[model samples]
Target: MSQTDSYDDTYTESQVIMTTVKIIAPFTLTYGMFMSLHGADTPGGSFQGGAIIGVTVLMLAFAFGIEPTRQWLKNSFVVGLVTGGVTIFIATGLATMALGGSFLEYDAFSETFGIAHYWGMEAIEVGGVALIVAGVVITLFFATAAGFTPERNRREDEPLEGVSDDD
Candidate 1:
């Protein structure tokens, strides 16, 4: 028998995994947000926070199954997250330039509006880097789980044109 014949694609739900993830997901998400928001003054930053947030989704997938998780998060939301992040980062840099400062010059905000430069950095870390990283990580994970099929319209039982069952 071929490997495909023996391999089962069904998802088996595990009560323990579901329960554990349900209990821990909230704390992990909160911690991720905290790391992103407070990273300017602390050790963790947007990348770390974003990864953690992404992992939380993975954990959910493991507990509930990839198909369900993918259904819950929709394609538009992930794309929007990435797009919004890029917009925030670009807008911040452009705002600085418009104020007669170099790109990403947080000091421009301080000088122009008497606002703290810390807020600018926080915005970049929280809104730009964090969202971009999280969205990308989730997207990649989902794509990987889906696997690759050479022909989109091909049926599951149909073999590729060049490949033989004996091979």
Candidate 2:
């Protein structure tokens, strides 16, 4: 049998799982945002919030099938999330340096631009750490679920040298 034929791609739908995910996804997402936004003041931080957000996607995948969820969430979107987060994080640090302060020195914004240090911290939490964590988690989940496939580019009829179907 070919590699593609050896893999089971079928999904058995479950009404209970689907219904539960539908009910829970929104609240989970909202809580994640709240954690990220309020992290500066509250117990939760960007990592926690981002992890929550990533788990929401995982919940969806479990309910709706991994392939469907992967199709719905394009790779570009994930890449953009990670890229934007890193850029925001780096820019925030660089901005502090540009203002004659050390990297990631929130006081610089407060001193030079009259911006509150709290806002700077919030930006790092919400725009930087949160996005990076969410994107990374999702990427890891998808990669693990997909598993590894060798000779992906080769045709089904093409055989790997020295390997025989008789084996």
Candidate 3:
């Protein structure tokens, strides 16, 4: 209501929000990691765990403005994370195929999905789902908050690198 109360360079009103997030974020993040790590032994799996981790990132964005979060996590880096996650999943499927099994048929490795210390599950669940979720959630937050139009325009106006405009 007052000029002093307005959002300024430092975001004075954020002190409380920042403090709360600082205190809670670590615990939530740790819990999320736990969920991801222990999912094989518990009820939840990558989906729930990934959502938790993604929520932590969202909470961070809320505490600190989207701009700061975006600056901290470049879009390229997040894209890499997403790409890596998908690659893990695809590689897992391919690995099974290479072993004369159906896609993601972990039972081929062992009677149970525990062969090789559950490496297959770990790759698909943790590497694929968790990373993808974390990257995508943060990327979505940044893109939506900062407006994805400029990116759309840039892509439409300019051809991709290494590709000719004539194509």
For all predicted structures, in order, the TM-scores are: 0.88, 0.87, 0.74
Tens digits of per-residue lDDT for model 2, 1-167: 75546655689999999999999999999999999888689898999999999999999999999999999999999999899999999999999999999999999999998979988888899999999999999999999997775676578989986689998
Model 2, residue 130: distance off in Å is 0.4
Q: Which ten residues in a row have the lowest lDDT in candidate 1?
A: 1-10
TM-score of 1: 0.88
**Tens digit per residue, CA lDDT, model 3, 46-163:** 7788788888988988888777777887778889978999999999998888877899987666654447737778879888988888788777777677654434667576765546
lDDT to native, each model: 0.91, 0.92, 0.79
Q: Check candidate 2 and list the clashing pairs.
A: none
Poorest 10 consecutive residues by lDDT, candidate 2: 1-10
Instruction: Kindly give the stretch of ten consecutive residues in candidate 3 with the minimal lDDT sum.
Output: 3-12
Candidate 2 Cα outliers beyond 4 Å, as residue runs? 1-9, 152-167
Model 3 misplaced stretches (Cα beyond 4 Å): 1-12, 111-118, 148-167
- Ranked by TM-score from best down, the candidates are 1, 2, 3
For candidate 2, give the lDDT of residue 75.
Answer: 93
The TM-score of candidate 3 is 0.74
